[model samples]
Target: MSATLRSIAMGDGTAPVDMLAALFEARGWPCSADSAEEISGEIQGSWATYQVRCVWRAEDRVLQLLCLPDIRIAKEKRAPATELLALINEQMWLGHFDIWSDGGMLLYRHGAMLGDDGLLTLSQAQALVEAAIEECDRFYPAFQFVLWSDKSAREALDSALIDAAGEA
Candidate 1:
């Protein structure tokens, strides 16, 4: 067995994986446990689809929840994407945005460390999903600005987060 699998086996007493799967199901998410260490599903948002995944870290009792935008960043867009992600991540309390080096896949990621019992409460799990989606919705337009409109990273981010009307 792989090291990841072995650690999970060590955590069998708390059943962290089972808890994660059940949490997703309870929230009406289409979750897949095809991978013993991860549960993933698509969350339908009014604006776009957020692909959400939860990967369990057994020994540490941490569950990493990731939300990825359906859009792919182009080669020329990677630098701007990285800058925008950095700007967005700075303001986040729960998670941060990341771009994959290989495919330039944009993601918003966070983790919850379960207590000694190593299980998530229904409310806690729901909060994770809610927070991820909320952050994704808030920051996605900035990405679009950089990807489609050729806006500079700062310009895109400014347009996304700034409330011009609030300036007196």
Candidate 2:
């Protein structure tokens, strides 16, 4: 199994964000902790380089993973993008995609609630990060279709959801 799948438990004594930093380190993804509560990393996806941030909320005992794809919607495209976000979120199982209202940046967000002991397993962390990336990668083309092409939100979603039968 990969390092990310190892059954390591965090939060025995160390902060959960530290555990995330270690996971990013193991993946060789450059990451840094701005404070004890948060760490950010860069992950390369099929469509773009994603900026991932893991934030630990000690008070709520929650860990949130935010993944931002390298796409920014123009002001005029915001309406269509918002429409697409709602459609995409409806199909999501774990995380949901949103556009940063002020900046028009596309991002995927998911949160995990830690146990009473504040322990988080490596697989949980891996799942959080991987799910965000996967969702962002999967929907990126839809955002592009809405923002850059002439496709409407529904059309873009339909186009993005198409599955390939075989490799070329």
Candidate 3:
């Protein structure tokens, strides 16, 4: 399955987490609730699975939105960063222009960064995240988001919980 990356803006009254899930569900995409205690959620659909994780910096009031396909099929489909960069340079998708990967994670940008173009601001990042999630729902009809807790150990425990949930 193919997935896109983008950002979103958090609004008043609605926390970022709640607003995102509600938006997806409104679009006919099934979404798990905030899962506030944990920072992630696994959204399941008939054909695909999506994992959305919100890494928040409470002291800075910032959040890093991450969404990826649970299945790593696209790893083979992915071109090298140089080739991906060329595609971005040629095709331009509104806010998305930069695409690269670090370790196991793929990263993209929407605005300008430092002196480089396509760096996303905090608000832009949030919007991009929301947009990416929406796009995934549209293109990959059957997708789910797997949520995780903040602490690494907690995330591991949550995974175990999910495994146990499935066994039951």
Candidate-wise lDDT, in order:
0.78, 0.83, 0.40
| Candidate 1 deviation (Cα RMSD) | 7.6
Give all TM-scores, in the order shown.
Answer: 0.81, 0.90, 0.38
- Worst 10-residue lDDT window, candidate 3: 141-150
Which regions of candidate 3 deviate over 4 angstroms?
A: 1-11, 17-38, 44-47, 71-82, 89-130, 135-168
Query: Candidate 2 vs candidate 3: which has greater lDDT?
Result: 2
User: Judged by TM-score, which candidate is best?
Assistant: 2
Per-residue alpha-carbon lDDT of model 3 for 43-63, expressed as tens digits?
553345666665544444444
Error of 2 at 9 (Å): 5.7
Residue lDDT tens for model 1, 85-154: 7877888888898887788788888988888877765557668888999988888889889999999988
> In candidate 2, which residue pairs clash?
none
Query: Which candidate leads in lDDT?
Result: 2
Mark the 10 consecutive residues where model 2 has the least summed lDDT. 4-13
